[model samples]
Target chain A: MMDILSRLNNYTTIVVALGAAVLGMISGVIGSYSVIRKQSLIGDGVSHSALPGVVLAFMMTGNKSTEVLLLGALVAGILAAGFIIGIVKNSRIKFDSALALVMSVFFGTGLVLLSIVQKTPDSAQAGLSRFIFGQVSAILKRDVYIMTIVSAVLILLVILFWKEFKLFSFDPEYAHTLGFKPMRLNLLLMLMTVFTIIIGLQTVGVILMSAMLIAPGVAARQWTDRLWLMIVLSAVFGAGAGVIGAFSSSLAEKLPTGPAIVVVISIIVLISILIAPNRGLISKALRRRKSKKGWLEKGVKGGDII
Target chain B: MNPQLEIQLIAIFIATACALPGVFLVLRKMTMMSDSISHTTLLGIVLAFFIVHDLSSPFLVVGAAAMGVITVWLTESLHKTKLVSEDSSIGIVFPLLFSIAVILISKYAGSVHLDSDSVLEGDLVSAPFYRLELFGVSIGAKYIYISLFYLILNIVLIAVFFKELKVSAFDPMLASVLGFSPILLHYGLMSLVSITAVGAFEAVGSILVIAFMAGPPVTAYLLTDDLKKMLFISGGMGALNAVLGFQLARFFDVSISGAMAVMTGVTFLIVFIFAPQRGLISIALRRKRQKLSFGMLNLLIHLLSHENSEYETREAEHCSLANHLHWHEGYARKIVDKLIIEKLIVVENGILKLTDTGRTYTSNEYSKIFNN
Candidate 1:
């Protein structure tokens, strides 16, 4: 416990936690759009698809810079989103089928590429697999700066197009009938989501990153019905999970940061599902019990039943 | 038997086994469930290992299969709450379970030879070394037997419940109305998928299991609408991909399973774009042909309608027709030329006139459209 507190004041711990918190916040923000749009699992496909891009970026530039690698991840994620949309649009294959097929195939390609990179003489490729499960301890100060800038820009855009996104997410056909271009809005939303997934790859890796995108928004949704409030609450829950997860992982001897963050957020989801008002399991059950009790009492008191 | 042959046989067996259940998964739109099951089975193995303290226990398979069904049930229940959407439920459930497993491994089993990488990306090249022994006599690789067990198991279950599986997958309501329980079938299929995943995990890993599960079945779907034929073709494609992927892996000195996945994708892509009747190119070509024929019919109708009318000369001119029909000038000329070549219309001093054939065809088409 003493070691954890002393380490919390240290430079690297603060930086890593900050990075995770920012990643959580932005994922929560953009993830609300995806979750509401019923495309939450698309983030899973996009993250897996980003693997090839990260590796290809390293291969192309021979630079292990975070910005360069993430740019590559973003491009690959967009391509994956495009493929999913295209397959669902053109073929008889449903969305889930296309997502599964695309995700596995793309990750397979990444594995092949990773093997090729291993065979190469380049010693710099050693850390590339960190993107798979993530290595938050390896996150540098520069990566945090990049994440902050990207998060700011994403937030700014969300604010600027708040009304348009609101209409698009809720009722796209109505928006289209009102002369708004839903396709453009959808494309923009997908791009933002891809960007968020790419930036967070360094923290939670590809697989767990999906949880970060989903758990926060889902938890926040139980607390409120309004979209804006949900977004705000989701950001808070996500950022909180990030801090606590990062701290706990640091305190532990060999705990992995990525999965730790995911576990924390998942606990938040469980709590939200059970205890939150209105939409919570417990509250709904209580309300049902109250109504049934009232009806039974009325029946007995009025002698309407034996 | 050679080790190389054993590896190929194992790959083929796993591929065929996975493709069988994959047919139902694809048809039922639960391909993502396979993905979730593949990830959470690791947790099942871990929890089971903690209790049994034996990696090779048959109970491990049961544990993993139970975990897979639980994952599906949880996701379905979470969705049933209607608080969260189905995809969100899936996105939430698997990662949470997988993360707990990861944390447990790192925190407790870090030194117990449970490398998560090997689980996620298994090494097929090493499978031939684990020899199967039958009464003290070597019987090639153990994975070959393992995969064969799963293959036979899947084939038996699917064959025995072919009609039940078919009806439930296509129409669950009808299946229940006819005395078949969809829930029992759902859990049964989930158990089969879980065991199949466990068997294949040491060979192709979990992610490639999804490729084997979804790729072949979806590709087969594009080629045929018949369920039996789809199953046959999916299994065949899976086996073919295994052989080709093995060869490619050898040539490129890459991961064998990765190459197989890529090949699965390649085969699907080729089938998706060029299948004789149902491919993308063929579909697009069909649409184009329809458009051309519709254009020809519209041209014939226009010429027939304007024939012998006071505005015939002005309305039937190629440029005037383009303007009136709102078609591109080039498209208008092309349609007019097609009509002329078919003797449907003839130009008399820049005025278009419909022939007897054109008149009869246009009136028939017009009446048909009206009747519909």
Candidate 2:
């Protein structure tokens, strides 16, 4: 029992999980747009890209403040986004192909940089590779404060841009006709995504941050069609998962919390996917089976659309 | 004795296997699903490792592949339900499986050797250590042999059913009537994707493996439109990127995975901006030239107009020759310049004259317009 308490008391683990909750909220909010835009994989792309930023930040400032590291993450994340956009706009590359191309290249650069960092003699900071796979157990209080501030800022920005984002998302041509610039709006949205993603690096790390960003939104979407509600629910669900995962991992020793919280959020998302109200798999299958039976029982009417 | 040379072969081998079937994946628009499959296979790996009790066991890889296929199956099956979309279905299913895998690793295997770090970092440093021995003579790394077998399997499958696969990818509904089972081809491709994904796990980790599967083929598709060109270009791009990327990664002393991804992006960008007709610079220049030529036509129209015609005026009323306004100042000048270019117009005292050749050309066009 004492072992459990001691493990739980490791402030890093709790801080890490709490930080994940904050990141999860921000990711959940942004991920809704990503999913609706059919860019669920962009999360995966940006997550891997964040690695170079972390390493570069460490190399320059030697102060791994969540701020400096986040700056690195923001720069790299935005560049990756620009690369994807460039591929789509400038090349004949299909959207999926462009996303894939950008994802791999950014991830490759991060990996190469990590290898060099690891080889730098007498540098303990080179061990940031562990951060790549997500060892959130080392998250400190300052990290949590930063994450919280970032999350708050993200939520505030979303509120401010809610109307603009909605118009830009579903009807870019219409938005243009109404004098709203799609490019400018999209740039802002992508920037917000960068800030949120950068803050998320400490908890989910470079590899799985996108997963965290996208999963909760996916789950919450299953439960609602309303965009506002979806974002709110996703944030709540993501935070809940973080709390649960951290609490559980705290029961054991050596269980890295980043992966742990991600796992929990994933499970929550799965539950929603499997059985959420109108969008759940079981409900749909059941509806399909019922409809098939109904059609078999009743003669097909010429006017019946159902 | 040269590490670089030995690694280059390894890079070539991986890229060949990756690009071979990646051609089909890009065509199928299933690259995203393949990526999800790679991630969800983590559950398969963890569960397999747990069951088989060893990470190095062949069963671990096999288990992971099986899980990958299962993910594809589950995602596809669930996607057909009206409740959600394909992307959402994938988003929901695999992350949960992967998360469960992570939870399991934390609970049961926290003290065990396997962890997320090992999974994501991959066993690249140690991959060369695992050799495949044939009749007491080591052939190569076991992964090399395994991946080669998978590669050959993919090649044979592609060869045997090229026509069917092409038809299905281009138009599944039509392919269905032609007695080609698109579902069968789909499953086959998904299985191949899974095999490539799980097999490369040790060499480059799951994310890089997915990158190899999707990135190069995607880049190739951009440069070529023909199916055959796509296949060739995709494979060529993959092989080229892998070799250069691996070396760059090694040289930069960074993780191999990150460097490999960056090189893929850079290559695609270079092709995008400078490649012949489709490249950015060329396309922009072509547009500029088109606009300039168009502007010159407008200038000619203004020049040939009647002195009082004011047709170039932004808010001018219709011409008195409106019925014949098809030959307005803009049209007259356009006609004259076009005639001159066609060797039909001549200048006498700064006044335009239509040569016989110009008259004939104008007659045909005027007749067509009048008739219309």
Candidate 1, B18-61: lDDT as tens digits: 99999999999999989999999999999999999988888988
Per-residue alpha-carbon lDDT of candidate 2 for residues B61-97, written as tens digits (9 for 90 to 100): 7888889889988888767765456666676667667
Off-target runs (Cα >4 Å) in candidate 2 are A1-18, A206-208, A251-256, A263-267, A270-306, B1-4, B121-144, B246-260, B297-372
Stretches of candidate 1 exceeding 4 Å from the true structure: A1-4, A297-306
Candidate 1: which docking quality band?
medium
TM-score of chain A of 2: 0.86
Q: What DockQ was computed for model 2?
A: 0.46
lDDT tens readout by residue for model 2, A1-306: 887778777766677667767777778888788777777767667767777777887888777655677678788889888877776777656667666656666666666766766766866675565555555666677778888887788778888989988878777899999999888988888777777766666556654576676778878888998999998998898788777777776775655566677667767766887888767887888999999988876756634756
User: What does candidate 1's lDDT look like per residue over A48-159, in tens digits?
Assistant: 8888888999999999877788888888899989888888878889999999999999988888898999898869999787775677777788888888999999999999
For this target, which candidate reaches the highest TM-score against the unseen true structure? 1
lDDT of 2: 0.72
Q: What is the Cα-based lDDT of residue A211 in candidate 1?
A: 91
Candidate 2 iRMSD in angstroms? 3.1
